[model samples]
Target: MSIFHGLSAFPLTPADAAGRVDTGALSRLVQRLVEARVGSVGLLGSTGTYAYLSRTERRRAVEAAAECTGGRTPLVVGVGALRTDAAQLLARDAEAAGADGLLLAPVSYTPLTEDEVFAHVAAVAGATGLPLCLYNNPATTHFTMTDALVARLAALPRVAAVKNPAPPSDEAARHAALRALVPADFAIGYSGDWRAGAALLAGGQAWYSVIGGLLPEPSLALTHAALAGETAQVAALEARFAPLWALFQEWSSLRVTHAAARILGLCDTALPLPIQPLPPSLHPRIEAALDALA
Candidate 1:
């Protein structure tokens, strides 16, 4: 089975003043990713504000990403929803919209049994012929998939990879356990913090990245360096990115990232309501961080 590899961007879903999806900005973002030579672009994931977007908005974002990407690289659309039926619908819509694969996360409303999670994955996998990448982000969602659960789900024919956002230490162990459970064909992707390059060096096949959406060139370069076993280059890049990572450790990490993107002229800092912009007081600090890295 063909598995996705290399740097995959978790792009932000650009929205208008009324909070509607902005295809024009989204198209520009996708074009930037292609220019930067990222391996793939992921739409409607956490960085894309998937939870804040409506079903219609999600579909539009996926279609726009596919249209903009124009097969320059693979596209993965996040198909996570609070309801299983809705997730399946989104998965089908994503496939119709030309997504190469779907990143599915467990339901968030209630904690699901292992059997329920298995059934959900099976249902989405069965709903569309597209490859599936399981998204495990326990920080936002209440439930976390156990190693055994991942092993069981890895047996499904449609399941191709796992996008793990657990902390670095846990991610290492999870990768080891999951690798033991599944065949070598099944890929393990990394997310969370500045540990992605390290994880990739540790045998992760892909890096699912939020930072890539903001600074695709640097992120892709770092990924290439890590994959090439150039530790010096990787360390140098990580050192430059340390300031940004420090900001992410703050309470308003997403807001800071979004705001920093706008400052860099990448996209607007406009986020969906309930996720207000970062405090004005921190603008200088964010600008300095961006400038140092730039």
Candidate 2:
């Protein structure tokens, strides 16, 4: 069975003020997440700011994470790039760096046909020996993986799981239908802090989480409750995370989460250019919100 089963923490890339990836800081961050005992660690994910970094930086980030984890935990590296060849190359690199699995999204410049999407994933799957997770994040990628395509990819060798962002409306039913459509063994994980509980409650088996990266213990508590079908406990955990989720709602989670990490003294709060840093005014609110998690 694949170890890609539970809460996979998506950590932020700790970069220096000049936007250079701080490998030492990143190593420590991965160690912290590993020590927190999250089910898996996702490096160079969306939260890791994969798109912002150069190829060499991304490679170093993956290597650092794998080196730090050192087989203690599953390291799922994101190999998402706009071009198929680049994605394939990253997949190969992640596999070589000892990553446990690959997470790929259909990132594109123009509108992509379903065939193009399928081909892109297929090429990456062929490139790596590691298991692959199809990241269906339409909001960011602007390319949606329809059910037909998902079923087809599920049949591909090395394609093991999917990270789906739960829809805002009819979440339970939507996830339930998705679950029924895919193969029985194919894992359908959910992200989107607001919809995680609903996705888990609706039979989704995994959560590719951003908040969980910073707060692993609490995130695991919520995941464990969902798996045991403990509805009340799940609700309670969601309520606990509401403050952080609310901050995510107001500003982007990328901003608030990095700010929260800074507040907790996790790392330097320097995000890459083009993506602005969290405003100073929201620091107190973010600090207070993070305090609530404690």
Quote each prediction's TM-score: 0.95, 0.97
Where is the poorest 10-residue window by lDDT in model 1?
166-175
Q: Worst lDDT window (10 residues) for model 2?
A: 166-175
Model 2: runs farther than 4 Å from truth?
none
Model 1 residue 235 distance off true place after TM-score fit, in angstroms: 1.3
Give the Cα lDDT of each candidate: 0.83, 0.86
lDDT per residue for candidate 1 within 1-294, as digits (tens), equals: 243688888778889756689888888888899888888897888888888888888888888899888887899999998888999999999999999999998957767888999999999999999999999888776778887888889899889888876346755565676788887888887887578877877778888888888778888888899878888999998998888888887844567778887877778748988788887788888888787677
Q: Please tell me which predicted candidate would have the highest lDDT against the true structure.
A: 2
Residue lDDT tens for model 2, 249-283? 88987888898888888887588887888888999
Clashes of 2: 0
Whole-model lDDT for model 1 versus the true structure?
0.83
RMSD of 2: 1.2
Residue 259 lDDT, candidate 1, scale 0-100: 87
Best TM-score goes to which candidate?
2
